[model samples]
Target: MKRNVLLGIAAAALLVSAPSRATQLITEEEAKLPPPKGAVEVQQRGILRGPKVEFVSPGDAASSPLRLVLKFQSYGGAKVDPNSVKVIFLRTPNVDLTPRVKPFVQADGINMQDAELPPGEYTVRVDIKDSDGRPGTAVFTLKVAPK
Candidate 1:
């Protein structure tokens, strides 16, 4: 009986913390800036070339399982199919794409990826190119908090 009560309390705490953690990512001041044009706004890396990408959902944290959905704009203000927009994620901490992450695709209107990574400090490099062969690179860092 005591174990059941503790479990219920823990579950309730999780439910309350999840949404707040997500919302805490974006602030009103950052939203005031003009949105990126025809490129991936790699958070702190500034703007680089590629189909424009907007985070449908805010926040990109290093959790056990990371879910990300990116909406793309046509390259250079022209129509470019998502297929033509190649996107890959390279593990930056180590000079390889191996044992840590898997690449994903943007089939429809959005680029969605779900990556399950071990808990550690790491950086991921985003490599992208358009149909016309314009290339762009941006680096994103993830520090996984220990459980």
Candidate 2:
């Protein structure tokens, strides 16, 4: 039917816009940056409820070109501000990853297929804010095993 055709076109468009074959999320140079001198402080206030972010797949360790999925849940009836999403490589002088994954970010979360990270362990920090201005952050380490 016409609906089916339209749906197919929509899917194709999405695929075209999605990030493909991500050889590396963080470049070797960026990864070599010195560790932060001190602990990074993050504080959230005012808002009675905040958003939550979680990795839905590819646990702590996975091979290259794996599916990277993140789930976001907003609280207090607030909706996620997709544009406020920030992805950072947690190294000294944090490297900004937001631009690299911006296209895949959505109000719900991020679903990146073929995320080909180099073989190593990486600490990443994801910061996001809800429509009400409440901020949320998640820090996790991903170990990409060698092929």
Candidate 3:
């Protein structure tokens, strides 16, 4: 009878310990996310050449006339109709900025000069549609420095 009682107590202890083993904490590095695909380039531009967008803003937050530049490149020889493409600018969460959207037309490549944006973090989504209107979109993050 004592052996059976000891076995019962051991079983209860094992059950109690099992719950702690199942409650392991997960680290941020263990939940790392994947990077975005495709080739994307964003820069400040003074001239228009191709399907490129330039984001410009005041070097200081206290200044006016903020702008953004966007440059588009086709991957794997996939030609995107500039006229059928659209650009949407969304203010990043927890940031001071305004949201904007604009349509881009193909003219010797996609080029938008003097595109204005505020000084803050932003998420820019570019959508390119095919002749049939099938769409492909790319999202990029842009940081505008204070004037």
Candidate 4:
């Protein structure tokens, strides 16, 4: 009787400790998916001009100033609002950056001047967005030297 009780207890323990193999519930019919939305489109234009080095010193070493010139093409699409477009610059290493809004006078081009950068390698990222909220981005590397 003792052996039978021990065997029964072992069997009960095995049943209690057995791993559960549950299946994930799913409907027989396929799930309904939403239709795809229209994609956002953005374009960048123009050429950037600067020295091989990132820094420029026009006067005495102690008083020389640093300048960064950035240029790009304007959006050609009629749907894009030139006044609403904005350019953002992100500095690398130090991670200091700023944002500049393009003026409406020049709807087809961008020429920006930045003088607040310190000596280091900076990652310049340009973003253009249309009136409809579509956005495009371009990234470039700039190296600034000591004045």
Q: What TM-score, to 2 decimals, does candidate 1 have?
A: 0.43
**In candidate 4, what are the lDDT values of residues 55-141, reduced to their tens digit?**
122222221123334333333433434554444333212221323223211334343333433444434444554544555455554
Clash statistics: count for each candidate: 0, 0, 31, 3
In terms of TM-score, the best-performing candidate is 2
61-146 per-residue lDDT for model 3 (tens digits): 42213333444454343455656656554322222111222332452233333344345544556656544444555555655455
Instruction: List ranges where model 4 is wrong by over 4 Å.
Output: 1-67, 74-80, 86-106, 131-133
lDDT of every predicted structure (CA atoms): 0.44, 0.81, 0.42, 0.38
lDDT of 1 by residue, 37-134 (tens): 33332563556555444445225445644554555454665443444443333321124332222234452233334444455544444454566655
Point out the worst 10-residue segment of candidate 1 by lDDT: 20-29
TM-score of each: 0.43, 0.75, 0.38, 0.37
- Give Cα distance to truth, residue 31, candidate 1, Å: 33
Model 3 — TM-score against the truth?
Answer: 0.38
| Candidate 3 residue spans exceeding 4 A from truth | 1-78, 91-104, 107-109, 132-134
Name the candidate that leads on lDDT: 2
40-112: candidate 2 lDDT, tens digit per residue: 5344446447798887778868988777789999997899999999998877778898887887889999988
Error of 2 at 129 (Å): 0.8
Q: Which scores greater on TM-score, model 3 or model 4?
A: 3
